[model samples]
Each structure stands twice: as structure tokens, then as C-alpha cells.
Target: MNRILIDSSVHHMRIAVVENGKLVELHWESKAHQSIVGNIYAGRVENVVKGMQAAFVDIGQEKNAYLYYGQERATTDSNPKEGRKLKMGDTVLVQVTKDAVGEKGAVVTEELSFPGRFLVLLPEDTREIGISKKITDTEERNRIKEVLKDSLPEGYSAIVRTNGAKKSKEEYQKELDVLLKNCQAIQQFGQYAKPPALLLQEKSPALRIARELYASEVDEIVVNDRSIYEELLQAGEFPQEDGVTLLHYQDNTPIFEAYFVESQAEKALEQRVWLKSGGFLMIQQTEACVVIDVNTGKFTGKKSVEKTILKTNLEAASEIAAQLRLRNLSGIIIVDFIDMVSKEHRHLVQEALEQAVRKDRNKTVVVGMTELGLMQITRKKTRPSLEQQMSVSCRYCNGTGRYPSIDWTVSKMRREIESIFSNTIYQKVIVTANPKVLDAFCGKEEVFLKELQHKFEKTIVCIPMQAMAFDKYHIEKQKDS
Candidate 1:
């Protein structure tokens, strides 16, 4: 059974999609750092660089939004046919396509779209009726296309969402009306509103997910908050005839814990994931890309070594795809599967990987295996991954996960003390450093410190400061203690 569990009783709202008792997708939204990806704003052109064919629009965000007006990149609303050039002091309606990530500002598009439960309304377009690629049934696709053929306004276009399949024309029309009303309201308000004003806000993350799951195989939608449960029902987000049950969780146990989502989500943050077959996967996220390595640990098939490797690789392919969606890891990815000599075996593994990722909401492309036995894949990134959102860089290791070795620190300290003695007339010196480093510097019987003192003809005292960093040391000089 497919179930969407929403836990909104905490500061950060979390949604987990479980299919067949296995967590497949996880999402969270925080009140403090709310996302503005689908927001519509009346923005003022702050700067226009003709050379770059882009403009910087002030949308009342922390950073000015980037708008591309190039011929190829211009949307229908940008009016490329008339050759409209945005200039400073000009106001226009724009929708946020991508949120601000890192130092980059939110990416805005003049082509505005309002997404509904069954359709996404596009304003000022060529009346194109597009359907989702996921709705692959030819007869159903044609039926939906016919239903929405003449329903839209003359200047409006829309894309039939995946869940629109098998829905009644009235249902489609009802959603269309709501979306059209929303679009019209935004346009009418933006005309007289001041620049940098917000015209519309997207639905909250939990409600938004529920609205999108009408046509899915989901049978149950559970919410821990009574208010949210009432809101979902009052909005008529799910069809009553679809046999989808709306349940308000009243269990004293936390919603996530009750569904086993808390433990599953915690595993997504780990670097090593153990497979059921005793094999393990090493997943590492780096600045450039995410790298995953497959290892056959303690898994020896009864048949042969080749069979063991192939089995492990096939299993890993599926887990890797699940991890990508669960962790929301995006951008370039390189996978190093176990070596297989047969060309046919490699093809099977690649096919398995491609099939597994098809269920992901984000667009993921597999670029095939390389000559060096590494598979390259690319996933679209609109926001930070789960790791980036949940954790910060380690201060002790500086995020490198490595510290200066004791031998290295001890050697460096000796050289620094020698240099200090040669440069100054101090007869005594006191060195303070991390305890672990002090142990190395003092040696087994304080022999190292004694040797250094004899060489410098100075009384040296070593103080271990637990608070000091391993890579750091401080020296104080005294004139004949």
C-alpha cells in the first residue's frame, strides 16, 4: 500500500511517501527558511546588461533575481517576436522557477504557470495542450487531450498532469477554473500593485504533496495535525470515489516514528548503507559530484565469483536510485560498480539503474559507463541536498575529515621551538597544545622534550590544553625561570 505520512506537529514540517511499507521519498519545509520557488512577484528591473542578454530584477528578496532575455531562452510571455527589451525601472510579472541556492539568486521566468491538482495553467501562450510523459497509456492520453481541447481560454495553454488521467471532464474543468481564477487574480492585482510586491504564494509543502497524489496508487493519506487533516478534506484535494482514506493520526507516538520513517530517514544521512545481501555501498558527497562505490562484503554466492559480483551490482543499482531520491542528492554522480568482464552483464546493470530511477520525481539522466569502469549520471538540482540542509561543516576537521597526524604535529613543534630559541634570548619556554599532540611531543618518558631542552639550553614546559586544536600550538617565552 502507498501512504503519505505528514508530520506537522514540529517546527519543520516533514512528509514521507511510503510504498509497500518502504520509504521512497522524503521532504521537509521549515518556517524559518521557507521556500519561494512557486511564488509570483511584480518585480522591478534593477539592472539590464544587454551584453549578457540578462536582467537583474529586484523581487524584494535578499538577492536580486536573474532573468534571462536571450532569444533562445526567452519564454512566450517575454515577447521575443516583438523584440521587447527589459530596462531599468520597468515592472513585470515573474514567477520563481528556482529558489536561491548558495550565492545564486532565485531564477525567475516571465512565463507564469499555476499548478493545480490535475493541470498546470500557462498564461499568454499558444494554446498548446501538453500531457505529462508519465501518462504513457495512448488511449488515456488521447482521452485527456480531447477533454481539455476547447476548455482553456483563447490565449491560455495548459499541461495535463499525470494524475489527470481517467479523471472526468468536470473534474478537469473544475481544476481549470480554479487555476484560471488564480492566474487572473495575479494579473489583475499586479497591474496596479507596486513593484517588488508578492502577488501569490504557493501552497504549503504538505498540502501541495497531497494535491499532487490524487491519481497515484496511494491509498492512505495520514496527517498528525487535526487542522491539516480538516484543511485537506475541506479543499477537496482527493477524490472521494478514488477510495483514498484520510486519517487523522491520534497515536501518542510521533507520526514519523510510528511509520518507521524516522529511522529510515536517519539512514539516508549516513555515508555507508549496508545491503540486505551482506554487501555494502560507500556513498560520498563531494563539492564536484556524488560518488558511490559498490563492494561485495561477505557475500559469496554458491555459484561463482562472477555471479556474486553481478548480484551485488544489480542490488546496488536499485539502492543507489532510492538513496538519490531519499537524500535529494543532485548534480553530477559517478558510480563505480563491481568489475564485470562480460559486456552483457554491464548492460544489464545499466538497464536496472535506468529503470529504478524512472520513479523519481526529479529528472535523472544516466550518461552510461566510461572506459575507466565508472558510470556517470546527472540529476537536476534546484535546491540544497538533505545533508547540506541538516548539517554544517565540521569546525575541528574543517570539513576535510582529516586532522594533522601526531607525528607531523610533534615534528613541526620541535622545529618551531628551535627557531624561537635561536631568534630570542629566552632561557625558558612554555608550549601549550592539544593533549594528544602533547603526548607525542613528550614521548614515552618525556625524552623528546628533554632532548629539545638540552639542544636549546632552555627549560621547556609543555602544557596540554584540551581546548586547543590539534593543528594549533602557542609558545610563551620567559627570561630564565
Candidate 2:
């Protein structure tokens, strides 16, 4: 059975999907500090750069949003403005397309879409009704198309989601009514509101995931936070017939700790993943792409070398796909599979890897292997990877992942001592360094400390700072006793 655990007890929200007691995906969100993407707004045109074919919109954010006229042509061309270009102080309804990354502000568009449980209601897009490609059953697809064709309100249309395949007519009408009501509300709110104001806020991360994933495929939704649980219930996305259980965890123990998902999450952040076959995968992420190297760790086969390599490569392929989803690593991915001598074996591994990534909801393309024997993949990125979100550059290494050797650290300390005593007027000198750095001062280096004390005619004390970086040191002087 599949279970979704939502832990909102902390300041940030953590949502995890567990299938048969194993964690498959985890999503983290914090609304207070992060950018607000997918939010609808009434924005004011601060500046229109006709040459750049873009406009800077003030959505009441620190940096103005960028809206490309070329990209906006499809969505905004039908606006009442006709052919007139957006001018300063012009009020336009926009939705955030992407969040702020680095120096770039949020990307907004005039294309407004309201997502419901089973359909995405396009308020401005009335041209046609579309069906989800995943719902490939011809008869069911035709039934859904006919149903929507019969009752689709005039001047408004929607894209039927995959979850709508088995839904009842009453269910369709109920959700449609709610979506229509929201569209009318947004229009009314836009009428009263001025530019640079939020018309509708995006659903919280927990609620959003619940709506998208709560079809018959999901078994249960367990939320540790009462407020989020209540919100999911109010959303009315889950049907009780799917053995779906919604339980508000009233106990003091957090859900992750109880389910042992915290440890699984920690492992996902690691670069090396050990497969059950004793083979392992080394994952590395860079600005260019993500590279995964397959290795045979301890697995030895009684069969030929080719068989051993093929078996390890097959196991690595499965783990690689799972790791990508768990880590939320996207962009171009290159997998270095253990080279199989047989052409048939190589084909099998490639097909196995492709099938494994199908479990991931994100769109991914397996580009197959190159002549040089590198397997390439392209996965769409919706947000930052787990490691990128959780970690920062080290203070000493500054992201180089390297630090000065112990001998170099000791020599640097000597230079720092001389410079400090010559400039300052004080008796006792206190030197504090990381515990690892101080390890060099043990019996042998103690002699150097004694010499420095004699040369300076002052007392010098070495203290170990556990929390300090190995290359970091602090020196302080005191008055004569």
C-alpha cells in the first residue's frame, strides 16, 4: 500500500511518498523565505522594453518580474488591449511562471490557469478541450471528451487530467462548479484591485501534492499537522473508496521519526548509493549535468566476467533511476554503465533503465547509449535538487571541497603568532584552533609552542575548538597577571 506522510510540525513543510514502506519521493517547502511561484497577481507594467520584447512588471516584489512579449503573444494577444503594447502603469492580470533564481526575478505570464483535482481550468483559453495523454484508453478518452463537450460552459474550457478517467458525472460537475466559481472570483477581485496586488495565492505544498496524487493510486494520506490535514479534507480530492484513509496524527511523535523516513531521506542526500547486489552507484551533480558512475563493489559472480558486469550494470540502472527521483536531480544525466561485451546485454540494460524511470511523474527521456558507451538522459527540473536545497559551501574550502594540510595549518599558526605579539601589547596569548588542527600540536609540535613562548617572553595556551573549521583560528591577548 502507498502512504503519503505530511509533516508540517516544523517551520518548513516536508511531504514524503512511501510505497510499501519504502520512501520514493520527498518534497520540501517554506513559504516565508522562498519565492512565491504559481501565484496569480494583478501586476503593473513598470517598464516596457520594445527592443528586448519584454516588460518589467511590479508584482509587489523586491525585484520586478520579467514578462517576454514573444512568449506572451499566445496568451495575451487576445486581451482587450488588441495590438497596443503594454505601457507603464498598465494593469494586467498575470501568474508567476517561475520562481526567482539568483539575480533573475520571478517569471510571470498573462496565461492564467486554475488547477483542480481532475482538470486544469484555463479561464482565458476557450479554444478546445484536451485530454491527458496518460489516459490512453480510446473508449474512456472518448467518454471524457463527450462528457466535457456536453457540459463545458461557454467561453471557458479545461484540460481533463488522467484522474478524471474513472470519475462520475456528478464528480465532474461538482469540481467544475468550484473551478468556475474561482474564475468568477478572480475576475471580480481583479475589478476591485489595483496593480501590484495578489489576486490568488497558490496552494501550500502539502495541499498541492495531496490534490495531484490522491487518485485511486494512493492508499492513504497521513498528516501530522492538524491544519494541513483539515485543509486536505476541505479540498475534497480524496475519495474514500480507494481504501483512502485521512488521519490527523494527534501524537507528539513526528510521522517521519515513527516511519524511519528521516534516515532514508538522509541517505538520499548522499552521492554514493549501495545496491542490494553489493554493487554501488556514484552520483555527481554539476552545473553542466549529473553524472552517475556504475561500479561493482563486492559482488562477485561464479560465472564469466561479462555476466558479472552485466548483472551489476542492470542493478545500477534501477538504483540510478530511483536515486534521481529521490534526490530530485534533473537536467542532462550521463550514466557510465559497466561495459557489456554483448550487444544484446547492453540493449537490455538500456530498456530496463527506461522502464524504471517511468515510475517518476516528471517527464524524462532516455537518450540511449553513445558509441563511447555513455548512457544519457534528460529529466525536466521543476525545482532545486535536494542536496542543493539542504547544503551550502564550506567556510574554509569555499566549495572546493579541500582544505590546507595539517603541516600547512601548523606553519600558518606560527606566522600568525609572531604577527600578533609584535603588534599587540599584552601578556598572555590564547590560540584557539579546530580540534583537528590542534592535533598537530601534540608532543612534537609542543616544542614549537615552547620556543614561541620563550621568544615572546609570554605565556601561550593552545585550545581546541570542536566547532571551528580546520583552517580557521582565533587569537586573543590578555593583560599581565
The residue-by-residue lDDT of candidate 1 on 139-248, one tens digit each, is 99888878888677888999988777788888888888888888899999999999999999877777876776555688999998888898898877675677789999
Give each model's whole-structure lDDT.
Answer: 0.82, 0.78
Angstrom error at residue 282, model 2: 1.4
Judged by whole-model lDDT over C-alpha atoms, candidate 1 comes out at: 0.82
Query: Which window of ten consecutive residues has the lowest lDDT sum in model 1?
Result: 74-83
11-104: candidate 2 lDDT, tens digit per residue = 3567888998899888766534554767899999999987666899999998999987554344444543224478888998888877665466
The stretch of ten residues in a row with the least summed lDDT in candidate 2 is: 75-84
Cα RMSD, model 2:
12.8
